[model samples]
Target: MNVYFLSGLGADKRVFSQLTLDDQFIIHHIEWIKPLKKELLSHYAGRLVAQIDTTQAFQLVGLSFGGIIASELSNIVHPEQIVIISSTPTGVPISKFYRGLVKFLLLSPFAAPLLKSTNSLTYKFFGADTPELKTLLKDILHDTDSKFLKWALIRMSSWERKTRAENLYHIHGSADRLISIKLVKPDVVIEGGGHLMVYAQAKQISAILNKKLKSEEY
Candidate 1:
């Protein structure tokens, strides 16, 4: 069976470097493609669909922003199951204060710069704590295309989906700062785990993946 994985915003497959899945499943990491100017996320997902080998049984594992992309892909590829980590298909939550603040920032000339910046403040805020995690985050951010980053922000803010996915499973971090558990009801929660727990808490995540995905016959 083929199991495809997608990384978070401005990230790559390295996000899953620590993950260990069942040997019966072949893992393929879907790399991000450059977005067409002003492209809608659903349309972008359509383009991404071409990369999947959909002739056989497959599953999807997406983290953070990639979770949104995975949800969009489900409308087209119909995976066996899709797992979400630290992401909500419904939409990302923004506090009233941040909403008001972003409304103003969106109009400012520095909005793009803010999105492109990979500074310590932003990394810390995103919960990349350990030196290794911080280094990976910095590298991923540096490698990310500026245009794609800007477009992803727009997609995140404007994403809209109603009704839950029947085959979708969610695994969240109790300590996730980027997406709080208080706002989401996940199928599983990793206590003391942060947004970047995919690396920090890889053992627990692997245990869940192996258990949840192992029994399905391909």
Candidate 2:
């Protein structure tokens, strides 16, 4: 089976560099496309569906904001399963405080630049503790498109799904600061893992994924 991987907000395929899966499964990374002005999340997801080869059997694996995109895509395309790492199954996980904050930032002229800048606060929020991890985080942030970041943040803030997608598997990090564990009930919880746990705890997460992806049950 083929598995399509979607990276977090403003991130690329590098986010899944550390993950290892069985030889039987082929992996493909879904690249982010430019969003139309004021496009709805559902419509944006519809645009992304052009990248997938739906003729064959496949699954989806998304991280952070990409997870939400995966959920939206699931509604449009039929995937065998979808696994979201360090992410929530529904929009309820995004609190009202975060929504208000995004709205406030959208009005500010400095929002895009500020969000694209790599800083100590960004490191702490992403839990980039190791030197290599910090550098990777910095590079990802530096390379992110400011417009896309702002647009994604706005879409995330207003996402309104109330139920989980079918055959969806959620893996959360207990120590994730950006999305608190208290906000969601995940299928698998990585203890001491942070927002970047997919990279930091690749070995453990990879093992879990291999098992889940290979199993008959979703």
Candidate 3:
């Protein structure tokens, strides 16, 4: 069997570097494509769908925003299993305060810079306190396009998945700052884990996948 990994926003395959999978499965890393200047979610999902190889059966594992994309992709082609890590099935409900904050940021170009300056704080919130991890995260963020970042954020805030897929299985961190664990009921919850749980708890994820794949074969 083949496993397709969809990395989180502002992240690449390197985000899953700690993962160790069994030899029974072939791993394929899907890279994010630049969305059009102003593209609809359906259009973006369609483009992502085009990247998959429909000729072969495969399972999908997606993290954060990538999980949302994976859900959209699953609508196009049924995967043996669809796993969502540190992600929620529903779009985050934006409160009035958050809406105002988003508008404020949009009105002030300097807002992005201000937010960038707080990277260390963000790192702490995500439990990435180690110097090496912080440096790696900074490098990842540096490579990310601001426009894409804003677009993805807006998309996620406004997006909703109406379809409750039976194949879907969620694995979340109890302390995820980005997505609230209270808002979601995952198949598995890792205590003390944060937004970047996939990186922090890769071996556990690998083991879960291996077990799931084995059970499916029987």
Q: Is candidate 1 or candidate 2 better by TM-score?
A: 2
lDDT of 2 by residue, 1-218 (tens): 88999999989988788988889788999999999999988999999988999998889999999999999999999999999998878986557888888788776898877887777898899989999889889899889988888888898888899999999999999999999999999998999999999999999999999988883553
Estimate every model's Cα lDDT from 0 to 1: 0.83, 0.90, 0.78
User: Candidate 2, after superposition: displacement of residue 63 in Å?
Assistant: 0.1
Q: 1-218, model 1: which lDDT tens digit per residue?
A: 78889999888888899987778889998989999977989899999988899998889999999999999998888998888988886775666677666556655677766776667777766788888888888787788876677678766776768755768999998888878788788988899888888888999999998877763543
- Write down the TM-score for model 1: 0.90
Task: Give the C-alpha lDDT of model 3.
Answer: 0.78
The candidate that wins on TM-score is 2
- Residue 162's lDDT in candidate 3: 65
Cα TM-score per model: 0.90, 0.95, 0.90
- Number of the top-ranking candidate, with lDDT as the measure: 2
Candidate 3 stretches greater than 4 Å from native: 103-107, 114-118, 215-218
lDDT of 2: 0.90
Candidate numbers sorted by lDDT from highest down:
2, 1, 3
State how far residue 110 of model 3 sits from its true place (Å).
2.6
**Which pairs clash inside model 3?**
none
In model 1, how many backbone clashes occur? 0
lDDT per residue, candidate 3, 1-218, as tens digits?
Answer: 87888888778998889888788888888878888977766678788776678798888888998898888877778888888988877666678687767756754777555544437677976667677667767777777766677677767776767665658888998888878798888999899888887777778877877777653563
lDDT of 3 at 50: 66
